[model samples]
Target: MQINKDRDWEALYLANDTFWDHGEASPGLVDYL
Candidate 1:
């Protein structure tokens, strides 16, 4: 799926519309960091 980078996903976090959030850093992304 394509993501909308223009929208502030952080605002969704502030508003608590975070059903899609995993509540932690993604394990798949740990290596990139």
Candidate 2:
């Protein structure tokens, strides 16, 4: 799963081509902020 830096990640998410946590905001990010 070597995603290129130039790739459009938003498109992949919209197309459901990538894995992700389908829930609330990321806990780690919340804690960091």
* Local distance difference test values of all predictions, in order: 0.79, 0.80
Candidate 2 positional error at 6, Å: 0.4
lDDT per residue as tens, model 1, 1-33: 347779788998899776678788888799789
RMSD of each: 4.4, 3.2
- What 10-residue stretch in candidate 2 is worst by lDDT? 16-25
Task: For each candidate, give its TM-score against the true structure.
Answer: 0.40, 0.49
What would the TM-score be for candidate 2 when compared with the true structure? Answer: 0.49
Clashing pairs in 2: none
The digit string of per-residue lDDT tens for model 2 on 1-33 reads 785899899989888787664656788989998
RMSD of candidate 1 to the truth, in angstroms, is 4.4
List runs of model 1 lying over 4 Å from the truth. 22-33
lDDT of 1: 0.79
